[model samples]
Structures are given as structure tokens and as C-alpha cells.
Target: TVLYYDDEMLLELKSVVISNCAVGHGGRVIIPTEIKEGKLIIAVLQGEVTVLNTLGERAAKNNMVA
Candidate 1:
């Protein structure tokens, strides 16, 4: 699942498959763009996740703090 927030609203996503995504500010999580100023929280309760950016590069696997 994913969550997003912008200057106007907030969004929550689930069962999403993203390739080359982008995310903006206000906690917005964009798929196929640049991830600007937000936080990505992951909970591996059952499986693992692979995140990719617009550059077709894999996102780092690390704990992040906004």
C-alpha cells in the first residue's frame, strides 16, 4: 500500500505496481516521477517491496525519516 499528500489533498494507494515513478511534497507519493519532499514508510509484515524511480533505478533499502 501507498499514501500520498499534496497541497490540496491526501491519497492512499494499495495493490500498486509502479515503474519509474515520481512523488511531490506534502507527503505525495508519485509513481513514475521524482519523489520530492515526503516520507516513505514500509512495513514488511509478510513480504518485501522493490521501489523504482524515474531514472529506472532501484530505490535504496533503508529506513527513512521525514
Candidate 2:
């Protein structure tokens, strides 16, 4: 599910693997370091997102909103 602006879906990501998806405002995500086996797992229900693995560092760090 995806919404641009208040469209709906709000934002949902559960055990979802991603190679793309760069939204803003919340549920952040960034892992474009030339894509070294890049991977951005998601499990948020509210806000916060800043995971960067694949040897890039920043294993996981989100506000965590169940």
C-alpha cells in the first residue's frame, strides 16, 4: 500500500523487503550506498525509519511504533 498525500493506507510495511521506496515525512528509509546487497526491511506502524545494513552500518534505528 502507498499514498502520496493523505490518500489513505497511511503506511504499512510488515516484514516487507524492499529495493526501492523513498517516501518522506515519516517511515523513513535510506540504503543507496551503491547497493551493496542492499536491503531495507520494514516493521513500522506509525513513524520513524533509518535502517541501513549491508555492511553500510546502522543496523536498525527507528522510533518504533507498534
Candidate 3:
């Protein structure tokens, strides 16, 4: 799952594996890394997020400014 700090929401990315990234929010950003062909689930509780993948990097937010 890819997260954007400015968007203030969690994204359930699909058909991709996530690795070597950091999750800053209170909840979890579930990526399809294990299955390799499954749906990604992003559960946000609080704070912002910055998701980094092989293609590029992005950020997400929840009330607080990044």
C-alpha cells in the first residue's frame, strides 16, 4: 500500500510488494508482500505517512502536518 501524507488517508495498493519502507502512523499499512498476488490493506489510526517503493516515494497525513 502507498501512503501520501498530504492526502490524509490510507490507500490499499494492489498487485505489488512493499519492502524497505517505514510506517509512521499509529496503525498499520498492509502491503501484499507475502502473497505477491493479493490485495493491500492500509489501516490508519493517527499521524502522517511516507511510503517509499521502487517506482518512487509518497506521503500521507491524518490531521497533523507533515
Best by TM-score: 1
Measured on C-alpha atoms, candidate 3 has an lDDT of: 0.37
| Alpha-carbon local distance difference test for all models | 0.36, 0.35, 0.37
RMSD of each: 14.2, 15.0, 13.8
Q: What TM-score should be assigned to candidate 3?
A: 0.21
Model 2 / residue 5 / CA error / Å: 24
lDDT digits (tens) for residues 1-66 of candidate 1? 433334232333222334434456865555443432453433212223444332212233232423
Clash pairs, model 2 backbone? none
Q: Point out where model 2 deviates above 4 Å.
A: 1-14, 25-66
Per-candidate TM equals: 0.21, 0.18, 0.21
Candidate 3 per-residue lDDT over residues 1-66, each given as its tens digit: 233222232253323234655554854544345432332333333344444462222343433454
Model 3, residue 8: displacement in angstroms? 23
Stretches of candidate 3 exceeding 4 Å from the true structure: 1-14, 30-66
What's model 3's lDDT at 2? 37
Model 1: weakest 10-residue lDDT segment is 54-63
